[model samples]
Target chain A: MDLAPLALSLQVAVLATLVAAIAGVGLATLLATARFPGRDLVDVLATAPMVLPPTVLGYYLLVALGRHAALGRAFEAVFGTPIVFTRVGAVVAASVGALPLVVKSSRAALEGVDATLVQAARTLGAAPARAFVTVQLPLAARGIVASLMLAFARSLGDFGITLMVAGDIPGETQTASLALYDAIQEHREAAALEMALTLTAVAIAILYGVGKLTARSARGA
Target chain B: MAPDGDRPSLHVRARVVASHAFALDVAFDAPPGVTVLFGPSGSGKSTTLAAIAGLTRPAAGRIALGDEAWFDADARIDVAVHRRGVAYVFQSLALFPHMTAAENVAYGVSRALTPEARGERVRALLGRLRVAHLSTRRPATLSGGEAQRVALARALATEPRVVLLDEPLNALDRSLRRELAGELREALGQLGVPVVFVTHQSEEARALGERLVVLEAGRVTHVGTVRDVDDAP
Candidate 1:
């Protein structure tokens, strides 16, 4: 019945979703519009997390952001703490897991916008970036919102990667999923059941919202 | 020397090797006024306009508006689409579906204009197109003729150096097409910029065109006064 784990999960998930949404939309736009060498390679690498085992992804993150790595060293120098084994680490892990969902859905959404409309904006004295902001982004918004919701849901339920990257330190880094695991291990059946039900209900609500947005966008199109 | 020496004319020479075994190689000059790019489907009329607007790159070409060169393959000079100051009314109309008619027209208004001046210009344009009553309405709510007018209004709002209209009236009924063709001709005549109007319909071409450039199989088959082209064997 402890609420601390759920609160921490909410905080981490919100931050993770923000990170994922920004990076995901940017990558999606580049993939949808730009032609460049290694474009497919970039797409594959971005989408790798979705199919890669969580443990493998966790291992990569650990290596890439570990205390000995330059990124981790730089983080410590600026923030006076290493990135791993912290709530920030939980955010990073969840963000990585959530990114491919955002990217895939957002890319589809952006690509669905009428190319002629963008070209019209270009002809009307709008720079390419201006046209994207004023025309393409607004037209693709509902689907992008749905993608963000999916990402938030994914961030909320992240388990294996969060466990590996942000150790389940009691009261500090123990998210709902981690705490549920601890509860079941300790034979706290009621607590485990309650946490499981809560996570499932939240996820279902988010998915239902996503479905509504997607359906409306399809109809609108 | 050309008769209209003081007026800016769009001179285009292009060779484009398009996909699906299609190739476009054409050259012509559009003097100030309506120059109808008359051609059947697949004759690359839209591609010609696109090249002039910098929307499509030609394999080899020089597109110059009077003294300013918008694109030159040999010179490796290609002005960006927005920078080229070309107003294009696409075949689909391409109105910003999310915006109201007034907002759609206002979008291309120059940033150098003050907010008050911008709003006034948008209002004047909508009024001129006779779509002032539909300013707050979205493209979905507008009838085909209404939408066409709004698209024309949006194109002219840019005060472009040149105007390109690709089958702008084709989607309307015959009566509406005739009605708008006159309005379109009058609207474009006042701009004094080189206007390239594309259409496969000879009637629409005759109704709006002063000069005509006929395209067949991606090549300029003829270029002359509308009367001369119609009188040809």
Candidate 2:
């Protein structure tokens, strides 16, 4: 109900969405462009989370980053602190849970780039890297933008993963979703309703902006 | 440099295989003049142009210029498309929708040309192609003929050893195609390079090519002058 928890949640979501979107675009570009032996398998792996239950993803994070886990131990040794039960852990959980959205959308976008355009670039004497940067990447920008926005929305409202991995630490890790839950648990209906309304408005506005931008890009082309 | 003078500027012998759909297995040559490849739909004319442009790799074969080899079987030397000095004007024109006509043409020129020289070359080429007024325009705004010229200028700007044109006028209407074919033939002659042109129209092939290479079912059916094709059909 307090603005602090909501604010912290927004920060975590923004960071998680950014990292996830970058990782997703990179992975998707590889999947859509490269001809590696197991590239199809890589696509399947990226898309796995899209179909997987968010709670199951949260469960995996719990196993990987819990204090007794190997990853947790490594983080502890490197930073003298564990990630789980902290804000850092919340971002990791959110990113993992939302990763598939970015990958699948970006791949679809990249695939939409015409092979004829690529061949044309090649014939015009553009190297592979130059062609990708000048031709393929620019054309696929709309898809990447859409994916990033979707990932952001997904991160903004994440509940199960953050609760499982970060344990809803107040002021530090307790985000808007967690605050809403706590208010409901305490029967503070007014506070919960206010938070929910604000969250909904912000998400809608951000998504609408991204959608308009993508449409403009398509039209401009 | 068709060094032997009797030999062609470009020669290719290769087999390219696509997954379950197409395989372009053929050998051909284009001397220092207009050489057209003619075929029906799905007859692999475009595939052959792509192979010559080095956009598609042949299964096992050789590609050679007049004196130097672009590709060799025993040495396994396969030059990248850009480095091969072969320009391709695709069927769609494939003009960069974002870039202006001048910029698109300048893309193929290397650092050897000064910025002024590059600009001059682009302007001169656009003028020569009779699309100079559209120099600052993007592909998205241009007419079909304008876009085609932009693509042709882009291909010629590179000063390639050989030029590959895949159904260059296929997208145009009958009237435009007829008008442009004569202009295109003149431009090809001016470029002073071997042209590997592809067309579905037998008349177009005969009109543009000094030599006509007919492709049927992914194989080279005839390799001779236009008169030879007239005799066959």
Candidate 3:
């Protein structure tokens, strides 16, 4: 069986996880610590992707990052290529789909850190950002790592948004899930089963790792 | 100018409505010595400390260290907590659990110090607090008294202009509390900065206080020397 789809999926998932993790942690920290006028609205928007239908999210992404949009135009200007129907589009879709998991989990982890410890740090001459980096972030590292694994799993299996944004171009944008779907539609049972089992195994491994991290953190706490 | 000459006094006059039922309206002065904020639970002793430290904003009041105003609601001037040059040992002794005792102490030490100087300062503070031997250990492994000393060491690491201790020894047993109280007094006596020590225990207050500010139901009941307050009719 051709492994192009698996290779492409891994590449996209890795990039998507990196992008999602950075944005997710930042959003999570802001939500956990700061109070602003539109705080709740920002939180709702951050979490909308998780609960919204994939098609809805896909349509939104298309509108927001399509050729006519500012972000899309900027990207095309820089890279000389449109974002939609490309591997870059796959990464963006997966990152959006996986962002909520990272944000929710990371926010919980950050908030779990003792508020008094942060106060003590502040009183001990640490600025707010310094206190977060030295105390809160270290305390919450385990949960954040687990969140990253969950994000990776989500990114790897992204289908509907990826399909809508990236489109299925065989050997290019056709990721593992898309390949599995294509195989079954063509009555290729062996190829379909192989892809299904592989994805399942990888997901299970990631979930198991996440569980261990969570258990370790619980015990440490 | 403060009567104490070069050493500044902490002057706090503030009103905080913690909730519909609990409002703290207090005013007091802490000169360059231990000034015990004596009150029962829920009397707002800790809240008063927080307000001075700039962690809690008072609705309308002013907090000043000598000539410099740390917080002034009317003037709209509130120094951020870190820039206030105030060190605080919380009631829970909020040591950084992820750091070793030495690292925790070093954390507040001036970054202007070279790494070696910082290490030396941490060592000296821990040694002075009698927690030097436990420097390699984390807070979780330390006993209550040991953790208390480590917390005190961390607070003093910065050589703050003011120090706030919120019942730092309250978690210890009576005997340990007595033993550590003496050490705390000796350590604080040498600082020459205004020290605000909070406690609900009358004994602890008397043991450490040079001046006493008593609170009852979020209002200042009395402010006098320990002797004056105790000797009152």
Over 4 Å off in model 3, which ranges? B227-233
**Clashing pairs for predicted structure model 1, backbone only:** none
Each candidate's DockQ: 0.91, 0.73, 0.87
Q: Second chain only: TM-score per model? A: 0.96, 0.93, 0.97
Give the DockQ (C-alpha) for candidate 3: 0.87
lDDT by residue for model 2 (B57-133), tens: 77888888876777776788888888888888888888877688888888888758889988888889899988899
Per-residue lDDT of A27-93 in model 3, one digit per residue for the tens?
Answer: 9999999999999999999999999999999998999999999999999999998889999999999
> DockQ winner among the candidates?
1
In candidate 2 the C-alpha lDDT for residue A24 amounts to 93
Candidate 1 lDDT over residue span A36-141, tens digit each: 9999999999999999999999999999999999998999899998889999899999999999999999999999999999999999999999999999999999
Q: Clash pairs of candidate 3?
A: none
Which of 1 and 2 is ahead in lDDT?
1
Q: Tell me which of candidates 2 and 3 scores higher on TM-score.
A: 3
